[model samples]
Target: MEHAAPQAWLLLALWLWPLLLMALAMRTQWRWLPALGALPALVSAALLPVGTQLSLPWLLLGTELELDSIGRVFVLFSALLWLIAGIFVATLMYREPIGSPSGSNHFAQRRFNALFLLAMSGQFWALVGVDLVSFYVGFAIMGLAAYGLILAYGDPAARRAGRLYLALTVAGEVALFAGLVSLAAHSGTLTPDPSLLAAAGGPSLALILLGLGVKAAIVPLHLWLPVTYTAAPIPATAVLSSAMIKVAVLGWLRWLPLGAVTWPHWALALSIIGLLSAFYALLIGLIQRDPKAVLAYSSISKMGFLLLLTGLMLGQPDLLGAGITAMLFYATHHALTKAGLFLGLGLYEQNTHQRRTQQLLLAGLIFLALALAAAPLTSGAAAKYLSKPLLQAAPWHWLSPLLWLMTLTTILLMARFLWLLRFPASKAGWEGTAAHPTESSAHFELNLLAPFLAWGLLLALIAALPWLFAPASFWPTNSANLLLALALCALVLILSKRGRNPLATLIGRIAPGDILGPLERSAQRLRTQAGRFQPGQRSTRSTESTRSTDPTSASETALELKLRGWPVAGALWLGLGMLLLLLLLAGAR
Candidate 1:
């Protein structure tokens, strides 16, 4: 029994290991602590058996770790990816050559290490968690900690991306929380409850769907992703897009009513949205210049497929047996491939003379995985084959074409992403060596390949999983639709090369945060208006002119300048006042 509940120890170790590492990292001469930190959780998760459950009555949330078959798939996949990225980050942990020497304690900062640890804890906890509340705590902590990374690194553009990410993330979290609340209120007393959540009926189910929708980067909530992925450091972007985002998927898997009533209408609507968003992101991705940005958009496209799967599963909760397996298989596929690409792009920055060679290699890998996304007869093809029966049963067969379109666009985007990610050597020698980096050693290259190789191994498992478990008779899969889809995508890419320049043309025309452009512009306009209205502008002009003529205005102008600073200061003070009043109101209530 003690061994059976080992997940409790695993859960505790996930949190405590990082904290210990961070504390040790704080005291040691170590600069690359982040990379070393993710190891224990990864190893423990792999060793832990599926169906294990753990409880901690002492904690506020009473920590839980339960492993369903699908959750096990996600846990191992996510845990491995995080560790690999951590290692990659560790390789670069020493200060940039431009900074102080290696031995300097300043090479690492405690704050950055702390945030990384907290984020990793959140991610690990979320992956292994059994119930809704435990999952939420992990999810919230990870989200907040990741925001810290954004603030730590982003400049003006990064900050804009940060703000966009934060706003959308908060909105998503709110929806998810609402769903949990509704679930707790409605579930019948007879139902068994997961430690994290009290069960509610359909309304709670709806909440979980909506909440997961935002976090999962489905359709409308997906816009912030490309911006954040583009702006973040390669390592940060890799984990953020790949592993961190899976938190939402895990959330939906654990919290939603998979075995309860199916919502076909909602499911259908979601499938349509996923189908469209999947293609739409690729189209936009095709036109973009930055490869990281392209990968971000590609992630959105890939995530949409998962969203569609979620919809289908919701519609036929009874099919959860196959549905959960399919979903797990699909999630693992995307995580590995996407993380590999993000890290590969980061490493692609290393090659100098072989730009075209690198580009060709990159394009091959991108399309290979994207084809998997399309379920081209490669293992992904088989995965897609499994999904067909579910879609065929839906009210309309036409949805299949939509699915094909999603697959085809993924092919096009994958091809386009390769071209965009291609390192153009046209300006070759003009840029310095920094722009064209080299692998520090064979070891470094191998270190970087860790995540990609891990993904490739998982993709290999696709062919084996269905055979071992369900053992369905072969339907004799056909490549005709797959070929037709690829050819059409190729033709589209060739004929519409002109559209590739649209990202530049649309930059000012379309803000990076998708629909938030208008709001951002409005705020900017308001600032401009405020700048003019403030007597500060007029006073500044007078003060400058007066410095040459009337000395008193210049002196008073300095006073005015000091007073202008007070507005920002005053705003802070006012914010504090408002906060105090709210706290008082809460106390009264």
Candidate 2:
């Protein structure tokens, strides 16, 4: 029997190897090597048994790495997704024509590969590390490295998206850093376990939620996801949607006192926010013309379910086991299926010339879509059944109908995605080269099969798991639910064909990243309005008129003047502090 001591290095390799590959890529010209970088992690995840631990006292204030149950599942799916996405990246680099034969595109490809490996390294460590500092280090690295991937295309939109993503990521990082410091300080330990944080409630928890919530793509904080993922390279988007997003969910699972503490206010608030985000993404997705944008919105919608489950766990701590299991299973299902769908889009772009190939691609699309919708026999179905008990419980019972409604919307959005897939390549922003007559169909088939097999294998695993280990009742055999979902899917497809999708048209008016546009416009208008008021000109205004001409403008100018001065702003802050002091004193009485 292999002892735990011998396997200590495996945990380190799982994360460090990618960084090694990243460094090698920076120094070498070989483009294909980085694609194989994830193999070590994948192999380790497959062979390593649970309960493996490695303690490093030399690391920052003593860090530990372990493969617990959650970490194992996370490593399995994350390594698998990264491995496949790496292959897809290699394929794109090799086959796709990029900006003439000049080596400039190759240089960009090299940069992309390095960044990809760095991001993968961060994601792996974030899940595997047990310590707070280790997790935060990994999370921050992943967040920063992904920005390069977002701007890989170097387009105007990609630049804009990269800036937006970076801004939110930085804000989240600040919150997360502060939260971790608070968590450590309050708990009186640098190496804090999540269970210990149960007593360290308040701003520590709130700051952590705000930080991770941004990465989780929770409502309002989620505007960066659809924009960034949609603009990133296809392979980058694949791992991003399938793997990187899970980091946030895992962070919540690892850092928060989910079942350990009762937080009714935050729990209810999170559940409500989750529900709104789900429907919000679905509605926005219906109108999007870009297939990638639709997938991004769909990802945000799926994330809402995870958030809801997390909230439920907070309320019903006794159900933590079930909730976490459901989340793991759901994450696994989404990672594979979503990655497959992205590659499916890439496959179609590459093989659009052949009629037979197009049909086969559509079949694959339907398979992935149905699985995502939680149709019978799919992994999503298993996940849904596992989570059903939680959703059906007390206060959450009110959300049950909404859950089904969300499913209906999911089916509709998937249908919309499939419908939009039929559009011309240019409309979808596909950059595939036309298939040469000499290019064999087998070549395209191989590329397409890479992601499909990954997706299909995951479905098979989930389906067999329920039958092999779970009790008969645990199977997703709710025939009525499946039937209802299928009927809704069919109804959506039918309505879509006759140009009678009135709801889609009406909801479609709201663009992808719905609130961002208005927010941006409002900010710009504020800036423009601010420019109209000269700083010293306020004195001139007072000299010119004895009577206030425009109360609104005068009030705005005065507010700006107060904000510009340190003394006035300090006095304002002092007055607010006194007010808060009085309120706290009164409350204490």
Candidate 3:
């Protein structure tokens, strides 16, 4: 069905609702209004299907809002995550109080409510952004407001985390701007065709790759992730992992010209990047003590595979469509699972002894882990299974073993994640403060468990639903995936003995990229060069004195102009007039 054009005001109103609600909340001191207003977006998303669109010609900046199958998936996932996070925040505000006896601070609903609305507006604008300017407008708004959540507390770690987050965010946005401009220049249209990006082969592709690559935390580009993941406050961390990262992924999907001709070198290079990233992050993640950092690396590792799947789709467009479908589904699973885990940590830190149903929370985490790790039954698992079929049809059959190694690496990293999880909640873990309760909270348990239960049911349905829409492919698949996942879990259980070992450090003993060392070297070289060229200092004084000592006669001879007379100037003007007169005489003839 053809989508009808929507009113620009409607698009504006969607975001404006949050802005207006925020203003009203500020005046009336109603904290819940922002969260409540967020719900209407969900309703709008559902009601305003693909056939619903609007265009506002009168407005200085035209606005648009509609839903395609892909847009529907993107918006739905974003809305659902925001909704859940909102509920979690609301509960914490009500139950935890302003400042608990344990001395951990809680947020005033109004303050958090403002930030939440701002983020929601940004997210809404991002999805509805049909034009480049608007899309960026939305993205920047979301990115900065997100910082509010990250550095909510003025803690040292939060301060460092915010710096790194801001630096990388700046880099990604700048690089993305280059690609967006290049895309417009080549396409010759303000409105972009998602598929037309397929034809973009050179710098345009690189800029997009580097730009989105930073945000996606693709291998070497991923420096800030673990730090910020561990340091950002809970609400901020959840939004970062769940919502913010997905925007980057969506940008990649939307901005790239997937419908254009495939460049094999780029495709192969991307696939390699994906594989390397998954393995590299897994190794680095294994040594982390902070549970949140482990998840951060885990997020990086998973995105690597998703990026790989995206690259492979270039070879098989039909199968590419299928891969994208599974990829989107998996993205949803990861957001929920990751957010749940972060909240789990926040809960655990609340009490010294968690008498709550910690087992249920643990189970929920395991399912979430499996979901991200792409274990069977869960969307993550199905996504994994689906991708294998897609890959088998690709040209590189030899890479399957390497691909399996990637999966095995995921299992290994996930095992380590579970291990990291245990150590943090235990008394023996790395505590920034020597005094911290290993126990979590009931509210936290309830918040996490609800999502787990919902996800578990979702997984069960996924396992059954395949027969309904997609016909099963004929293949004798490697059935060891689930067994491997479970076996790894069992190993962690048996080897929980690592609790006695000196727990790993959170900050890297050997920081990847040697970022600081290079900066130091570059600074020294710059200083040395600046000293040599110090224009008004001793160096310049010596050079000037040497020049001043030169003979005045030599300088006078050099300064003299060869053609200085007015007679020559007048003769040149007469010649120009003669040339014009000759041209006019020839025209008369």
Candidate 4:
């Protein structure tokens, strides 16, 4: 352990070095350095031992960081994502035209690298930190820094997404901070680790879940995900969905003591929420036309499955060890596969000229899609194999059929994603400049090769994960389940191809953010109504926007104006808090 201390210092350096590099980027012209910024973190994660610990007594009233089993895996994969995204961004900077102010790409490049590094550093530290305070610090830093990445393009849509992201982030942070403070107060320690506390009460658990749920983008809390990812750059979307979102899962694993004590109510509630989110995302995802939007909903659905697993673990505390291992495997598989899918979109968009290259890219996309859909012999199958125990257990037996349905839904969504990719939303301004039509075939080939190679390596790593971690004999038993799921997916596909599918209309009619669209419309109505009721306003129903000919419209408008002083939103927020408190009290009983 003493000898391992040096490597742990490397872990600290892993995060801190990014900040130093970020500072350097502002002063230096070298653009290649930021691409390599994630290298140290990757190295540190590879070399560090499982129990390596480091304390920062001088910082934040003394904090501790350690590379536990879960942390080790998280840091390794997260660093991998950061490294890949960094390379992609660096390459892209060279391709894109310089921004304003005398045509210098320096400002654009520097701004992105600085924010990217800050977010990466926060991700690394948040995973490595053992104590609650340290974790929250890292979490908040990452959440705040990511807003810049979303707003990098400075488009109207990007700005809107950034605002929404920040709003949700602040709300989540407040919930988490309050929960952490209350937990510490209850435990009589300012720096309580998950293991130090008993089974937390319902209020504490609910608050933590509410906070992290926003980050995780679980169902009703998932509106920001699609909007932001669709508007952000490809690299930003890749890392944001693949690596950043999973940090919330890690928070749940650490903040809540899974095996320490059982709370069936919280567990059951989480399972219900998780399952609903999964189904909702799938149904809405089927209608999504944008490739990135499809991917975003896919991520939401995947996160919901993870939430389901979390519930299973909580419900049956005896299965904690297996549950955690399953979750880690599932996370790893999803991260790699999902990131590959997102990055593949970039590859598809880049090669628009050559038919051969396009065909090859399509093949690769299908392969990646199959991987994500958990085809046999893939990492997804291995992960599913590991998680099957959850359904096999008592009281959770019903989840078996539901899990099967979820898998089918996932397959359908993946099919929709492939279909959407065929006709991506056009790059409005960069349509002609997006690809160099006259560029040499060799250069285009090389550019295409780089991303595919990255995907290939990641897929290979995922394929080998089961062998490296799980028993060698597990694959044979898992094959049958995989085949059955594939068969069902094929049946669905065939029906759709023949134009006989009954659900096609529902898929086409429903938007990506299924429930959120209506909620937003309702809010907009409220705002409009609130405006009309101002003192001394025209009593003629303000026929400016609405027509004077429609009597019903005028009446409704008048009624809305009359009731406009109501604090609907504020009251809703207050009611939500009260509901949570009531749930906690009930759970305590």
Candidate 5:
């Protein structure tokens, strides 16, 4: 109890510091602002013990922050990524100052920093907040603030991505709000326990799932991911992918009654949907030209795996403890590995002129990609090893074969990602291809060295993760999947070399955001057709004018115009209001 006060303060500072720095970042563009802003959270995650609770009853009906085992892991990995991304961004800004030659660029940089810090704060808040209201508020803030990051360049593609992101964010928020309200009303508390969740209705569950599914990038709700990832700056994309999307899974763990009851139907349905999300993303991802878009689909596929774990837990209450542990471990591993890949991609593109640097960057990218693909002895393999128990324990017999298929597809997806990096899009876009080439002398400077070191540290973490989580025996057991994937990849390569390339025609055939194009065109067509029925058009005006000189026709037209006017509309509204009041009064008895 003597140490409680300091721990409480540290917990508060974790999120508060970022908000304070966000304000400072808006006024002055400090290169280290991103790194500095994330420090408190990192420190808190490192020092605070699990089960440390800080309650603020006076705030927002009531608010509580706690660092459970899951929260600690989430905060630790997420803050680490945010810190590394910050360092990377700061290095870029240092080398090419944002304020040089143009106030517009400076302003844009400042806005990006501010939004970045705000999003970081919201991420921490959502991760630690134990109450439903606090979680929802943080989740909403994080989701909405990311729009600014996605819109950083203000280009047409960025604008389009931003608009789509904003629309989906708002829709998700509305659904979440309604779901939370319904859940709280039924459960009689903001901090939901198993009992509270058990009392909640299916509608609340569906609403909450729909709302969080958007953030999770579940198939139909995932339209924003590919485009937004391709358009957003590298650092923004890294955090958005690694940190923000993972929050949806955390929310599920916190709110769902995984171990309390069995819902076999919901379980089966979610499992199927999860499988679909995995395969669907894989198919679309394989054809993507942009590396970032491929990663976006990869994220979708990984989230689908987590969702599968969730469904299994819902059905088999006994698996909750092991399932939670596996999911957290997997999420942490993916987060670090994916962020490293993005950062390395940025490094590769920036240092393209230097052969040695390009080789080193490519090597690092391949290592991370292999780890992401669950190659033996890496973090990804360990994650899969951890999940085997859950998969085996599941009642469904077909899950094992599906898991194997997913693994094979994941390898293909990663290969596609690496292959596309060799031929980056010629158009000057977010990868910084349009920027001037860096001098060889600049390679060893502090600006470049710092980002490399940060990235290196992330790589070290990824390599060490498997040992930290699994035993020595687990490493040797998972080599079968890796072997099969490699053999399949080799066959495809040989086929391509023999002048009968199967995938040659499929490259770039399907655009990013696969269904979005058709949906948008259909919407545009509907709007065009709807325009034909609108009143007061030129044709209608011409017809009306032709009859204006005849007395009866003029009288009728005048009456029609008067009925369309505000005065007549107001009278009709009043009449409807009175009728509603009379009906209510009569029904009250």
Candidate 6:
């Protein structure tokens, strides 16, 4: 009982500490607030034992928080990434002048810190929460907070990205809510277990997948990812890619009956979709000119790989334990390596004029990229090694070859990302500038050293991941594949250098959100054509005047115009509404 009390407090502190720090940051606007906020989560993840549960009967229809094996790994990596990002945030706060006590800069700094910490708290909450309501609450908070981060700059591009992100986030939340309701009603419980999940209906499963898929950046639902990554601040982008997106995978692991049932049809369908997403994202990623956009697509591809593993597990229940471990390890490796790259890129841009620092940053980026590519002796290699058994055990004979292809594609994408980093697009605002002129040398050095130390620690973790996790050899057994990928990348580089560079022509051809750009344009054209058929200004004003007397009519008119402004949004809302209605009806029946 004594042990239980401590464990419960630790679990609560893991999330509450960040919230408390967020409140303090809003008042103090302290530069160190972000980093300090992450400390409790880090400590809790490290100190807490597995299976530690904290139940709150009075909280959100009786919620429970537990540190299971999956949650332990997730919390550890997430806290590490958040902590490192917090360090980078501290440096950013230091560089930018906060101005006077009541200045706009001060307010902006406090707002950013508060949102960052809130997101951190929400992430921890979602990760540790065992019940439906707690998970949903945390997920929604994190998603909404991230929208604010995306719009921090409030530029046209940032606003546009924020709009898209919010729309998708809301859609995902609605789907998730409906799915959870169905699951709870069907199972007659809020907390899920193997037996309950196994009996979950097909509609609930599909809805859950649909909801989580948006966050997971699953193919068609992935349009927001690249745009948001490009528009958001670097630190924000780092956490979004590394930690936020992985929440969906955790949701899948929790909600789906991976080890309990063998649904071969769902398994095969998901596997095919995963394979397609991997290759499709790789193709789009290669053509991207922006480094962040490339990284975003890289995330999509990695998610696809995880989805493939998930599908395999669904078909073969026996692979569950090994599969989950492999997935968790891969997720950790990718999170650390990707976050390091983003942070390193931010550092690279900030120290552009410093020749020595630039060189060092470039070297670190290359190392991180190599690790992401699963090069020998790196974390990626180790993760791939761990997954080998699952792949070998799969009934499908063609899965292994496709996985090899995906790995090769990943190497190429990383190479492209590195190449893109050489020519970062210039931007206005704090992102492009450095320290204030009046700042002391000591402060500047400290700011610079903090980010480097955080990045270096992350790199060290990536390097040691293999030794820490992988059994047997740290070297990838499939060293030949790595060599082949390297050779291919080299050959392409040589050919491009020798020729007129066909790859250059492909750059920027497809925008960050591949289909979205065209879809918006098409919608604009359609709106223009439709406007011509509408009543003249004078007639429209007369009609509006007639309707203005009725409050409900005036509100409906405004709603109609707003919906008309966003053509795609109308369609999405209509479809979602119908789906929700059907789900409600089904439940009632």
Give all candidates' CA lDDT scores.
0.63, 0.77, 0.64, 0.76, 0.84, 0.83
lDDT of 5 by residue, 1-589 (tens): 2345666777778888888998898789786898888898898899888899888765565778888898999999999999998987788655554435344467668768888898999899999999887798789878977988998767789989999999999999899889988999999888889867977978998899999999999989999998899888889999999999999999889878889999898889889999999999999898777888899999999999898999998998988888988999999998999899888888887786666777778889999999999988888988988888889999999988998989989988898787777655322211113333444653554557889888988999899998977888777755777788778778866776575666667767778888999999999989877766777545646766778767988888789989955347536954884785566456534
Superposition-based RMSD of candidate 1 using all C-alpha atoms, in angstroms: 7.1
Q: Give the TM-score comparing model 3 with the true structure, all chains together.
A: 0.75
lDDT of 4 at 509: 57
* Candidate 4 residue 71 C-alpha distance from true site, Å: 0.4
Which scores higher on TM-score, 1 or 6? 6
Q: Write the per-residue lDDT of candidate 2 for residues 1-589, one digit (tens) a residue.
A: 1344776788989899888998787667676665687887787789888888888765665668888888888898888778777777776645642323554556667767888899999988888888887898789878888988888767888888999999999999899989998998899886666577887877898899899989989998999998887778778888888889998888888888888887888789888888888898887887676778889999999999898888888888888888898898888888888888887777667776666767677877888887787766666677788887778773855787888788877877777677667643222222113332333454445655555565456545545654553446644544566576568757655675665644543543555577888998999999867756857545546755733676777888888988955346535855984786576456535
* lDDT (tens digit, per residue) of candidate 6 on 431-522: 11222222223222556888898898888888888887787686756578778877976776666557545565677789899999999999
Look at candidate 2 and give me any clashing residue pairs.
none
How would you encode candidate 1's per-residue C-alpha lDDT over 1-589 as one tens digit per residue?
2454544477568656776775675455454677666777776767776676776544443455666676677767777777767765555433331123453534235445656777888877777666556677678778867875655453776777778778877777787778765665565321235432323555666667676777677777877787787776666777888788887777766776665666677688778887877887777665555666667778887778777787787787767777777777667666766776776666556533454535544654664455445443444555666666666666667887787666666665565555554433122211112243344332334443544454345444544544554334423443565566568656554444444432334432333445556667799999878878987576657756767688786788788878645245445644874786576456535
Worst 10 residues of 3 by lDDT: 428-437
Candidate with the larger lDDT of 2 and 4: 2
Q: Give the TM-score of candidate 5.
A: 0.87
Could you list the CA RMSD of all candidates, in the order they appear?
Answer: 7.1, 10.4, 14.2, 9.2, 8.8, 6.8
Candidate 6: segments with Cα more than 4 A from true spot = 1-3, 97-104, 423-444, 537-589
What TM-score fits each model?
A: 0.77, 0.83, 0.75, 0.84, 0.87, 0.87
Displacement of residue 78 (Cα, Å) in model 4 is 0.5
Residue 324 alpha-carbon offset, candidate 1, angstroms:
0.8
Give candidate 1 regions above 4 Å deviation. 1-8, 26-29, 93-110, 188-203, 353-377, 423-478, 485-512, 526-589
Q: What is the lDDT of residue 388 in candidate 5?
A: 84
Candidate 3 local lDDT, 1-589, one digit each (tens)? 1343443235556666776776564445454564565665676666665645555433223444545566666676677667656655655444443324453543334545666777778877777766665676577667766665666555787777777777888888788878887887787654578555655547887897887888788977787777778776675677788877887777767776554556677668887888888888877776655667778888888888778877776555656577777677667667666776676555545433554445555665676666566655455555566666567876887778887877776776666666555554344333223332345554544634544454454344434433443334412233486577677656545444554334333334434332434665798999879988887656757857766786874475455543333235435744874786576456535
